[model samples]
Target: MKIENAVIITNKTRLESLIERFNTKAQAKFYIEHSGGNFSDYEQEHFVFKTSLSAVVEKLSVHFKCKVIDRSYLPNYIFTEKDLPVVLGQDGLVANTAKYVNGLPIFAINPDDSRYDGILLPHNINNFEDQITRIVHDRFVYDDITMAKATLNDGQTLLAFNDFFIGPASHISARYNIKIGNENENQSSSGIIVSTGAGSTGWLSSVCNQVSRMSETETEIDMDWDEDQLFFVVREPFESKHSKANIVSGYIDDAHPLIVESFMPQKGVIFSDGIEKDYLNFNSGAIVKIGLADSKAHIIV
Candidate 1:
């Protein structure tokens, strides 16, 4: 692809969030100190992130037209095919950006290596320029990470780089008719989590850990980041006179998708990548098909 513009995706730092909440930096600092929290940690984090971001912008602007957008505007922002996305923040930021970038190659940077684990960010401030040079020459390498897709019968769809949550919007049990292949049943549970290969180590792994501990046995929970299939687990399936827990978990592929018909009167939703604000209503009369998506997240390695 001929990349001519660089779109930088960013998220609000802790300090910025605090300031927004308290209406001023001084008030934010006072509130944190009153709550026995260390305000300096927030300040330090903000400084490091700004420094790194400035350097990234300077480098990208040398060759390509640059534009920056916050994480909140991702759903409404229109991205063109000739744009390269430069993600500079935590690993979750990268996951959040991938869903809306339309499979564009991402140059992920770790602003603070000491504070963030940065599993998705392979580029640091010092070495990112070399990768930029490669990008300028159209010689950069990338890895294709698999993604999960949730499609509603009404034609609305949501894509996830990590996983998808299908259930109620509240603390009550979710009611739905779940079908995988020929096996199908009505289930009442906390919710259902469908995990992509890149997301197996996240919420999916925690569920696996709990099950393994309860069963007192070892279980394999994670898969390759680029695996074609997806794993799903129904959380806390409750057996009742109206619901059955026979189909609690399974793998979803191209041929056999996990289909769910909602029986909830209200408050049911389906959201991806833990962003509950951006979701599809899944109340009664809604049927959703969960499967592997055709688009892959192309991250520069």
Candidate 2:
């Protein structure tokens, strides 16, 4: 497909966020310095990010129409097949932008390599324009990353490029009934995390770390990024007279999905990719099915 436009996705810099909170840059600097923090670090990070973003805009503008959008607008942004997504941020930004891109080829550029561990970013400002040129010539290579999806009985759906957290909104035991294949049980625990292969090293890895530390044994759960299967773990499942912990961790495939029914009267939620604000209410009477999404994130590697 001929690319007609490039949508550059970005996020507010830390300095910008501090300014927004304190109402001015000088006040933000005063607040940070007063708290024994280095205000110049923020300034330097912001400067590097802006410089990288400017370079990205300049490069893409030469070959295609370019428009920049903040990360906050991703949920409602309308993307087309002919529109190439050029993300300029950390690895998490690529995960955040993947859900809304509808499988468009994403060319992720690491804006500041010194500040970010860009696991998903394969290009840097030094060599990104060459890849863009290849993309314009229809010779760019990409990887189709699998993603997880949670669908409610009410028809509401949420996609996760990394993982999904299902539990109470607040810090409390999540009450729910979980079913996979034939087994079913009522459980009270911290929450449940369903992770795609692309996210096995993310939040899911921390959970694995905890298990390995507690059991004194190494646990390996990583998988291929394009694998169709997904993994889920029940965090801190508690066994009681009314709740059982037998149904804990398991794998979900296309033939079998994980079904959860909320028993919490209020504040139960299902959020993806660590964005708590973007979530679906999982209160009483809500049933959600977690499985592999039909779409994938086509990332330029």
Clashes of each: 0, 0
TM-score of each: 0.98, 0.99
What is the Å distance of residue 202 in model 1 from its true position? 0.4
> After superposition, which runs of candidate 2 have C-alpha atoms over 4 Å from their true positions?
none
* lDDT (tens digit, per residue) of candidate 1 on 1-301: 6889999999999999999999999999999999999999999999999999999999999999999999999999889888999999999999999998888889999989989998999999889999998988989899999999999999999999999999999999999999999999999999999999889999988999999999999866667888899999999999999999888888899999999999999999999888899799999999999998878999998
Q: How close is candidate 1 to the true structure, as a TM-score?
A: 0.98
Question: What does the lDDT read for residue 103 in candidate 2?
Answer: 88
Clashing pairs in 1: none
Error of 1 at 121 (Å): 0.6
Mark the regions of model 1 whose C-alpha exceeds 4 Å error after superposition. Answer: none
lDDT tens digits, residues 139-230, model 2?
A: 98999999999999999999999999999999989999999999999999999999999999989999999999999999879789999999
What are the RMSDs of all candidates, in order? 0.8, 0.7
